[model samples]
Structure formats: structure tokens, C-alpha cells
Target: MNQFKKYPNFLIGFDRFFYRKEHKSTRRRILSIIVLILIALLVIYGILVATNVNRYAFLSLFTRGLRDQKQQQDFITNIGIFTLAGLSFGFAMQVKIFNIGISGQMLAGASFAFIITHYLAKTGFAPAVGGQLITIILSMFVAAFVSVLTGLFKIYLKINEVVSAILLNW
Candidate 1:
């Protein structure tokens, strides 16, 4: 078998990777799909790098994000927030209810929290971890309130949740 060395059309290599065996098992098919996707990503990255040298800085940004403690903390916080939001969305999905206002709710929650925190800080409250904890709690409460209001719209006003969510989001 000749080593596939085509530089321009990597799809040929992908084809060989997928169609190597006569009988493709489920595992082999999945493996081929994964490998093809990886190769495609590599080709796209190569194009980006070739088009602009500054594009390579994405690698450094990724590495720095991994290495930096503050960045890691921020990432973890983001993951936690998204995980909570995902769970809420999943619960809504399980009930066959679509809530498209998740991001808007979060924004409202954050804005409410900022306002409360600023007020407390102005009133000589310690702007420390305790303040942060209060802010988080208040933010979550505001988010829940916003979600409940959306639900109420769907329930009493006879508005479709998706339409209401979109309008509220706007």
C-alpha cells in the first residue's frame, strides 16, 4: 500500500481512512468520523496560519488561558454558571417547554446583582467575599423571578413561550 502523501486534497486520505476495510463495523465508522473531523480541523487551522501569521497567537492564547490562575478561575466560574443554566434548560426541555430567554434572564440577573452590589458598597458595606456571595444569591433570585414571569406569560396570557421569550429578549 502506498503512503498517502497528497498535500492539497486531504479528503483522499480521509476516504482511505474510512474505506480501508471491506466491512465497516459501527466502531470503525465512528472512529473514521472522528478522525476525519480532526483532520478537517487541522486543515482549517493550517489555512488560518498560512493566511496570517498572527493567527498562530490563538495557540498561545489557549496555552495562556490554561496556565494563568485568574483565567482558570474565570473559566471555572463560567462553566459553573453555564452548567446551572444548562440544567435549567434541560429541565424545561424535559417538560416539552422551550425557553429561549435563558441568556436574557441571565443578563437581567447580572444587572440586578450589579445594581444591588453597587448600592451596598456605596452604603459602606464591605466589598469582599461576603459582598460577592450576596451578589450571587441576589442575582440567582432575580434570574428565577425573570424565568417565573416568563412562565406566567405562557400560562395566563396564553402566549407561546418561544414568542414571549423572543419578545422579552428583545
Candidate 2:
């Protein structure tokens, strides 16, 4: 056999990596298809499980247990509140508004909600469950409204939102 014919000049370095036995490429292709099918099946299964109402019953029971536990209830509430605050802060930042007083705003909203709920309780105007719901709704609205006001002030007054928010908190 001529040397040139046996070893092609075009095959060199990393380019030669693609040169493999015929069966290797076929095996790889089959394996890739199998993996993709498995992944698709898993995603389908997850969607089926999530959409089924039976799964929600389990989740409800789990949530009820957490609600019955004072520590767990407080932990979850705190996490939710902080997560909302963080999201609001991020939104403010994206709009070129500084949100330096999220913590203070959250505290003030909670305090105001507590005061209102206390007054309602004393006046006998609010049922226990309804009062709790109103308190939560009012607190969330107050927090969101206060944050939006801070953003508006920053836009209208040409002042640093961070400074304005901090002052509002004080």
C-alpha cells in the first residue's frame, strides 16, 4: 500500500478525534435517544402528578401541620414577608430607584396592621378569622403602597430614592 493512500494528509491532530469505529457512533446515537426519552417521560410524569387534585390534598395536610406549629408558622410567614420585600427591592433597583428602607417599611406596615386589628377586636366589629384575613391584606397593601410611594418620590423629586426611602422610614 502506498504511504499516502494508507494515511491521508488531511487527518491531523484533534481533527482525528472524530475517526471512530462505525458501531461507536451508532451506539452513541441510540444512547442519546434513550436518555432523551427518559427525560421526557419524567417531565410528563411530574406534570401529571402536579395537575392531579390528590397531590393538593397532601400539600394541604402538610400546610395544616405547619399552621398548627407556632414556630413553623412564624418561620414561613417571615420567609414570605422577606421574600416579598426582596422582590420589591429588586423591582425598585431595576427601575433606577433605590430601596434602602424595605425593612423599616415592612415593620411599619405590620405595626399599622396590628393596631387596626387590635382596634377592631376591641370594637367587636371583626370576626376572628375575618379579622386575621383583613389584617394580612391590609398589611400587604400598606407595604406595597409605601414602596411604590418611595419610587414615585424618587421620580418626581429628583432625589435619590435610597435617601428618600431611608428618611421616610425614620
Candidate 3:
């Protein structure tokens, strides 16, 4: 029994080397080749960047100038709004609901938000920060609501979501 077990273990090792045809050296060589290719690609990219150093410098300067003038508060608010929109769409997808009217929903949401903001501004009851917050909240809510309504319509009316979504855009 001991001899039988030892013979099978030896044969397994032999099979790994000969039958399986996989060698440690071959694996090491493949790994080295991949590393070399990656290094070469990095070197080429560095050379290209160095050659166009001036052009890159000008582009960086132009972008930085624009960044300096952009309002930080507005940028933060926009990012928050977009994050909410993405989350809403992701949730819809998770529930096996298709939200093809995302673009139109977003457009209408923005338009409605603007209308609300202007109305509040005219009424003299809106603070600057408060108005912005309300606009962002309203935009996300309206957009998500519109997407849900479209999904419901598709399920209840047997209307194709794609056609309804496209027509909504028009």
C-alpha cells in the first residue's frame, strides 16, 4: 500500500512536467516577456510625451486657466446632481426596469428645476444657497420620477420602452 501511494505521487509529478507539458522555466519566461513589453510601451510613451513637451505644456496651461475661473461651488453641486442621477438609473436597472428615457428625463428635470428656481427668485423668498439646493434636489427627483413613469407605462400599456423613450425625446 505504501509503495502504491508513493508510485502514484511520483507519476503525478512526472505527468505535470511531461504530460501536462508545463515547465516552471516556461512560465518564468512568459512573465518576463510580458514585463519587457510593458516596459517598452512605457518607454515609447515617455519619448512621445518628451517630443511634444511644449504642446502639452500649452494645453495644461489652458486647462488650468479655465479651472481657475470655474466656480468651485457650482462644480461641486453639478457633481452631486450627476451622482444622484447615476444612482437613480442604476437602481432602476437593478430592479429589471429599463430606463431608456434618461436623456429626455434629465432635460425635462433641468428645465423644471430652472422654472422653479426663477419663480422662487422672482418671489423674493429664495436665498442663493437654498435656491441652488432646491434646484439640484428637484432636478434629481423629477428625472427619477419621469424614468419610473416610463417604466410603468411600458409594463402596464405594453408599449415598447425604446419607442416611447425616443418619442419622449422628440
Candidate 4:
């Protein structure tokens, strides 16, 4: 078998990674897909390196993040937040609804928590652990309520979920 090498079309550089051919093999198709993805990633990395702009931002996080305690914690915190938001989106998907305003809901919860904490501090009744627990519980409710607005708009006003979500995101 001759090695497939050809000058790919400029408009579609991965055209050489052929999908439709006489050899109808799953392995060949998978290999072609993998090669296409690798070439795309290589192009991105090359551009990043050539420009000398925050090269380590994409390539060196494994060692650097572990070396710094604060960065490691921040990474873990972000993972947790993203995981929860992803799960929320997945759950919405099951219901044929798109919850694009998850971040807005999170912001609403954050605002609720901040206001509650500030008010308690002003009242001279700072109940640290209890206050935190209550804030968390109430914040969840606030966020859930914010999410419900999208549903309400869809149900009552017949607004598109995407439109309502973008509106709420603002």
C-alpha cells in the first residue's frame, strides 16, 4: 500500500484525511480522524509558539499548577463549579431544555450570599459556621429560582429558551 500523501486543498486542509474511499474500514476512518485532530492541534500550538504569547498557558499547567498551592486549589474549585454546571446542563438536556443561564443563576446565588452575610455582619450577629450553612442553602434556592424564570418565560410567554437565557445572562 502506497503512503497516502497529497497537497490538500487550502480551504479544507484535512481533505487528505479521506473518509470516503474504496477501503471501507472502520480503523482507517478512525485513524484519519485522529490524524486530522492532531494536525489541527499542531497548527494551534505552532501559532501560539510562533507568536510568543503566553505559551505556557496551554502547555505547562500540569507542573506549574501543582507547584503552586493557591493555583491548585483554584483549579480544583473551577473543576467543581464546571462539573456542577455541566451536570445541570445535562439534566436540562434530558427535559429538552437548554439551560444557558446557569452562570447567571450562580451569580444570583452569589449575590444572595453576599447580601445575607453583609446584613448579618451589620446586625452584629456574625454566626460563622451557621451563617455559611444558611447562606449556602438559601443561595441554592435563589439560583434555582433564577433558573425557573427561563421555564416560566417558555411556558407563559412562549419565548425561546436561548433568548430567555441570553436575556437572563445579562
Candidate 5:
């Protein structure tokens, strides 16, 4: 009987939590979520303990960024862009507007930024902040302009934003 072979609490706790009081547990919902998370961790650990390799693989994913500065910086930059995109999409979602052309907006904004920076570099006109603030402001304006076109497609052509977005994206 391996000490690690007989863990039933993870499964049993969840079964009990859900089926224990099926009809009257609204008040315990928050507590139940906490319990579920703890149980999930226990379940993940229990499954991973089957091999030392699994343990190493799981831990490596979390520690690699801490060990590599370049990887950490790349991760933050990529995540930051997606976070901004998500915020824009999420706000549109809240208003019941399905603006699926967000990608077009982002691409247009990036192009605008690239043009501004290229001009700044050519003209030898450098701002105190590396002209980054100007690039950001111009990018925002471009994105807003693209979004307005998307809205126009919706209102004037009665076209689905997704369709116009795909066209714009291309």
C-alpha cells in the first residue's frame, strides 16, 4: 500500500460538495469555490506525483521566467499587448456590441506607430521620451478611426462587423 496510492479525499470531497446538498447551498457558494480550488490543487498534485519527471515539468513552467531575463521581458511585452486588446474587446462586449474587427484596429494602430517612428528617425527629430508618447497617441487615433469605420459599416451597409473586420484585416 503506497502512501500516495490511496487518496480519495480529492474526489470524494468534490462529490460531496456538489451532491451533498443539491437543493440548499446558495449561501455556501463562496466557501464552496474556495474548497473546490483547494481540492483541485490537491488533485493536480496527486496526479503529478506519479513521476518525478511530471513534478519537474510542472515546476519548470513557473520558474523559467524568473531564471531568464530576456524570456521574462518578451513574456511581459506579449502579455501586455494581449491585455490591452482584451480590455478593448471586453468593453465592447459589455455594451452588447460585437466588434470583431479589433485585430484590424490593432494592425492599423501598429502601422501608424511604425510610420511615426520611422519619420521621427529620418528627420532626426527625437522627443524627450524617444517619441514613444507621440507614437502611442497617433496609434490611438488610428485605432479610433478604424473603429469608427467599423461602426459605419454596421450602420450604413448593414454589414456584420465580423465581415467588415475580416475585409479590413486583410
Candidate 6:
């Protein structure tokens, strides 16, 4: 019914690429997404304006820690610690297990490590790297043992891990 009808392949391909072939459905979806994003931005802008916050430095908080060497080291250490915990959680989830005792296990391990470090410091091993390494290994084993204990209870006692973990966490 038109001149472009003679070149069906090119017209169909062009329409699909430009999103003009979906009866405005594709265009409407994109337009809605843009509108929602714009709305969110406007709300954030309004809150910032109402608070009279310094707009120029509002986002500097995110990068301020990187400006200090010690803070950067602390940030990286925290990242490493959290990544290990996250990996453990992911692994448990993959095996159809919910490891809600993670927090308890981590706290117990840290406390054990602190006690070991304190004793080492008192026994002339003050700041010894080897002692620190041993302390870390011991802490990891204690944590794993505690976590496995919780799993054992779930498997044998038929107790919900979440409920047991809540008690353990407390």
C-alpha cells in the first residue's frame, strides 16, 4: 500500500531496531521508566533543597574515606571481611540451607581471637605476626565448629535454624 512496501526486509528491520513496530508498547515502556527515574530524582532534589544541605559537597561523603590512607586500609579490610561472610551465605543458600547463625558464629570467632591475641600479647609475643596468624586460624575453626553445630541441630533436632539462631544470637 506504500512505496516502502517494495523493500519489506529493510522496512521491517528498521522498524524493529527503532522500536516502531510494537504499536507504541515499547516506546511507552521506555517513557514510563524515564518518568519514574525523573520522579525519584526530583524527590531527592526536593529533600536536599528543603534540608538546605550544601549541594556541591553532598556526594563527597562517599569518597571522603578514600582521601585518608588509614581510612582506605580500614575500608579495604572491612570489604574483605564482609565478602567472606557473603560468600559463606551464598554457599549455604545454594545447598538449600539458610545460615542464620552467621552473626553469632562471627561474633564468637572474633571474641575467641581477641582472647588469644590478648594472651599472646601478655606472653612476650606482642605484635608477633605468627601469633596473629595462628589466632586467625583458631578463630576460623571455632567459628566453623559453632556454625556446624547449629546445622547439626537443625538436621537432627528438627529445629528451625532461624529460631535457633535467634536464641544463639541473643
Off by over 4 Å in 1: 1-64, 127-135
Error of 1 at 72 (Å): 1.8
Off by over 4 Å in 6: 1-58
**All candidates in order of TM-score, best leading:** 4, 6, 5, 1, 2, 3
In candidate 6, clashing pairs total 0
lDDT of 2 by residue, 61-134 (tens): 44664665786878788789789888978997898656798987888788888899788779888767876787
Alpha-carbon local distance difference test for all models: 0.82, 0.75, 0.73, 0.83, 0.83, 0.81
Q: What is the lDDT of residue 75 in candidate 6?
A: 84
State, as a TM-score between 0 and 1, how close model 4 is to the true structure: 0.70
Q: Estimate the overall C-alpha local distance difference test score of candidate 5.
A: 0.83
Given candidate 2, what's the lDDT at residue 111?
88
Better of 2 and 4 by TM-score: 4
* Predicted candidate 4 versus true structure: per-residue lDDT over 1-170, tens digit per residue: 43343433642544534645664588878888788788887898888889887877757745665667898898889889999989989998999887889899989999999999888889998887877898899999999998899889999999998899889989
- Segments in model 3 whose C-alpha atoms lie over 4 Å from true places: 1-66, 69-81, 127-141
Model 6, global lDDT: 0.81
lDDT of 1 by residue, 1-170 (tens): 44555453686665666877666788988988798888887887888788886875757755666677898998789889899789989998999888889988998898998798778779987678886897888888988888888899989999988888888877
Determine which window of 10 residues in candidate 4 has minimal summed lDDT: 2-11
Q: Cα deviation of 100 in candidate 5 (Å)?
A: 1.4
Query: Distance (Å) between predicted and true CA of 70, model 6?
Result: 1.2
Question: What is the per-residue lDDT of model 6 for residues 1-170, given as tens digits with 9 covering 90 to 100?
Answer: 79887999998865555455456586666876687677887788778878998875546746776988999998899888899889989999999988888888999899999998788778877766786788899999999888877878788998899888778778
TM-score of candidate 2 against the unseen true structure: 0.49
Model 3 residue 160 CA deviation (Å) reads 1.8
lDDT of 5 by residue, 1-170 (tens): 86544877876866776657766477677678787788887777777886545677667766777667898898899889999999999999999988888888999999998888788789998777746886898899999999998889899999898888888888
